[model samples]
Target: MRKSPLWIASFLLLLLVQTSGLWAQSAKKASYRNNNEVRTVQGCEYEVLKGLAEITEVEKTRSKSESALGYDEYSVKFKFTPMEKGQQLMADFGENSFDFFLRSGYDRLPVGPKYLKHYYVHKGQKFAMEFLQTDDKTCREQYTYKSMGIPNDLFEAQDSIKAYKIQIAAEKLYKKEKEVNEAKGIAMAEDAATQASGNRPPETAPEEQPKEEEGPKEEEPLDEEDPKEEEPEVDLNLPSEEELRKKVEAELREKEGLKKSPDEMDLDALRAQIEKEERAKAKAEAAKQAELDQKNAIKREKQAAKERKKLEEQRRKEIKAKEEELRDELAEKLAAEKAALEARKAAIREQVTNEIRRESCVYDEKISGTIKVISVEEGPTEVESLFGYKEYVVTLKFKPDNYADLPRKERKLWDKTFTFKLDPKGKSANPGATYVRIHKLFKGNKYNGFAQRLSSGVCNDIMVYSPDLPIDASQVRK
Candidate 1:
């Protein structure tokens, strides 16, 4: 058959598009297969941790490493006995168990020494772990483990466990791809060596015999059909990406404390207003109390001043009364002294008058004579008296005026001297009237007085009654 050029060109273009589409579909299928392999490994790890395990020991060690720069690297290791029920499941797994560890989102866990000590405290307790599955079936689950009655803080770490699991899976995938490439390179090198040594019989014979015996294997048909039969079913009930984003946004709002109703916000504002009013009321009450205290202090000061004035007035009155009492006592003492002095002077005068009258009666005769001489004598005898009075002896010589007509005893006194004792302080005689008066009789003056004679010829009482006659002043000798 003859074909048109336009039809042939259309057929070629269609074949190119279908071939490109098939290549894209094959690449996508391979990517999904790799992701499924990683998820299956992670799910098996989660299943193992879900069972309870008794923690036998926990140890922490520190070591210096070049990777840690200048700081020490800290690591924690745990030993646990898996429960009997989980042992059968662990044995059934063909793959090796994962070495589980906590890591931070921002950096490696146990960045400081305190976190190392935190794991050391939970040594011999049984713990149950759970891996909370996410909405995305392909993503690793979150890790949460705790012992009975233990706080969640003991198991807390930074970042999310899912992120660490994802990183572990990526490292494993890289290692697996590297191993596969290395194996393919080794096979290619072996084939090239066989072709180059075609002339060497012994090396070529051993290799060619194995290839011949293993040719056209019966398992080839089963290998081709397995992928189609074992493909995983997709779940249509899972949430979409947009729904996940909304859910995450809602949780963030709740955590940041922004999810509040209008009524709740108003209630918070009312509470703040009430608190402010109460504080202002308390301040006003405090000010009022302070003012009342100031007024009370002023009143107390005035009362104290009144009390002090009263005390001062009472003190002055007491002082005045004491002075008056002292003055009255002094006046009474002076008056008593004056009355006693006057009484003593009157007694002395009466005593002198009585002594003179007694002497005058004893000497009945009077004599008139011219005094020739007069003398006074003081001796020890004058001072021998109770009143300490002084006595004097008065000696007189006189001429009798009527010598022939006088009696014989009186006639003898004319040309004779007479002596008399006199008390000048009135202890025995009237000194004022007799002794003192006799001292006025001058020499050679005429005197008329009574004289009494004693038995010893001494005159006892001699009175010069008056001067004989008023002589010329120039004629009298004082």
Candidate 2:
């Protein structure tokens, strides 16, 4: 039995189709997963099937940054059976060739998540819904793709689907039109009422009836009905507006009060009793105001006390800081004084040691010098000039008033203005080469000296003598 390839291929395809049908029939129930366990991707809806199986409505989602590749669509379900008894849902269409006609519905879905996030079951197929994003401006493009959880090639004939959908829509619209026409007929009665009130026929008034002629007839009496009967004085018991309002208000208040005891009722006594409601209301308001004021006063007093305490604490801190600073300053001053005193004592000790050594170490020479007082002046320039005026002076040391401190007596001598003439040999002899030292004394007993060769004869009051040592005149020449 040689079979053509086409025939063999067709047989295998038919077998596959029959096997799928069998599988579908066997697994004819909707399946779904637990909602809490699965996380649906954003902008995505699940298609649940077999009562518990997970299904995705669509994998494609539109993004603001990028346009969709083709067209994203939402699916409408179709069933071979009724929704409930004879009622049929719009989404349900006849399924003849497939378990579900995914492609037979509208090309694009609706625009709300609320409507799309649900599961629906049709004849042989379970459906999960999704809505496509739509705008009045965007044109919809038709597309076909694989459905989640369903292994079958689904094709949607665009024109056929559109035509059937139009037919279904026309049916819906015709029904709506019939309802509208019925409503219009009912609404015309309002126009008739308006015409009667205006004493004129409406613009859309119905055609009038023809008048009927009659033979000679007996005259009916005018006002045959009794006037008294027409104007019967029936008791309506309808209260006036003011009285009704008061009665209603009182009833409402009574109900609200829930006063059930008969002993609580006393109409005559209640009427006699003066109403203190306004007074009570006023008293309540006053009491509230008083309570509020008392609270505010307490709060203000507490705040004031806190502020006072803070200020006092701050003042105490400031005073304590100031005292500490003063103490520190006094301690620093005392320390400085002690340092100065120690320094002065060391200088004195050094001076006394040098003096003792000078006296002990006697050389085999004796020398004497004198200076005659000439003139005096009192400043740095005058002191400087003294250095230049001396002649043939061996050596002389002069301290200026503002220079350094000297031995107490020398300091006093330098403070006063004076002049001196010097004799290097004796008190009245001619000096050899002359040299002079000028010094400035400072407030801190600090001295600075400047020495130079004297020009000639200016040390009039100066005297110089060496008892334990002698200087070689030639060697000492300036």
Candidate 3:
């Protein structure tokens, strides 16, 4: 069979591709030398495995920063041998991706992305995450490129057989750091071996020099100062393999010069200006506080004076009210005393008037008489007959007040001897001096039993009535 030259060339190209793919896969497997070993990086303890980043899958994905790292990503895993709380973590993802982040627990306590310090990890936490992040130069540009407008490419697409350019840069940085640490370790080991030979050469620190072949040296006797020599303790600040990788990445990022950084002299000037402004502010605050205090003191003094005036007015009003009350009480008491004295005077005047009225009607006794019979005669009993007449003897006697209750015989013996009987219709004497009826001449005829004899003034006839005897003898005679 005859083969064309073009067909032969195509077969050769395909064979070369398959061979390279196998070589890369085997290389990746062999690269993780310290995969299970515990090491401390950036104040945190963890295990790291170094290998070329494998592009396992490719698919369309969305992002707000630098567009899916050009649709290529690496899945890196990590394990903490014994995790603890509040540990600061940092890792070097290589020079291609200058920035790295922790996934799964610590996202909330401030610095989220990369390039600065301060990530306080969660309790007992580890991460195995895929990174499809922007390169440092592209992330700096979105002061313009909108995510919705058009996606900015962080990198070009990568080949299946090898890593992306950013990742290759990172790998070279990590390998260089590893070389440096290995050199330091070797130099220290050699220095210690030299000391064990017991012949002290110098006291300077060991140098990190190139390795050389040496023949066995015989043991020498100990010098005077050889026993005092001591190897230095291990350094806590030395970067582990993982931290060395990140430290290299940080150096490369700084060199890219994304933004201008201030040097030591500029920082010093900024510090001094801040201090000057603070001092001026403190002086102004003190003056403002003093002015406010003075205003408050004046207000308090005015208030106290107003209160004193109010109290003085109240005291004066109370004194005036008490004096008026006392004057009213005095007026009421004087009016009552005047009324009592007037009532006593009226009673005395009534008693005197009654005594004068009683004295006006009294009289003295004046005349006395005794009753006597002279003869018995008959008088007419028919109409139109001769006028009837009867006659009796008369007598007068001294039967005074003391002698009024005597016997008739004694009275007769005292009387003048004469018949003194009068007509039955004639008036008789009461043997008192108060009033009497007597004979009088009338119109050519003589009659007796006339109206009372005479007047006794304002009371007419007197009635001298006594308490013990109703009638008394009068000394006056008719």
Summing lDDT over every window of 10 consecutive residues in candidate 3, give the lowest-scoring window: 141-150
TM-score of each: 0.22, 0.22, 0.15
What CA root-mean-square deviation does each model show from the true structure?
Answer: 40.2, 26.4, 41.4
Q: 1-478, model 2: which lDDT tens digit per residue?
A: 7645544555555446545543443322222333311112221222222221222233234432332212333333332222222322123222311122344332332212222333332223453322121111112221122344443322322324454444444445556556766887788988878777865545786889998888898889786666566565988997899999988878987989955456778867665553566677789999999999999999999999999999999999999999999999999999988886777677557645544443333222222222222223232232122222333322234444344545777566544432222332223222223222221111122223221222334323333233221322332322
State how far residue 19 of model 3 sits from its true place (Å). 99
Alpha-carbon deviation at 10 in model 3, angstroms: 93
Candidate maximizing lDDT: 1
TM for candidate 2 is 0.22
lDDT of 3 by residue, 208-307 (tens): 8998989899899766666678978987887799989978777876889533345524666767788778878877887887788788878887887788
Instruction: Report the Cα lDDT for residue 17, model 3.
Output: 48
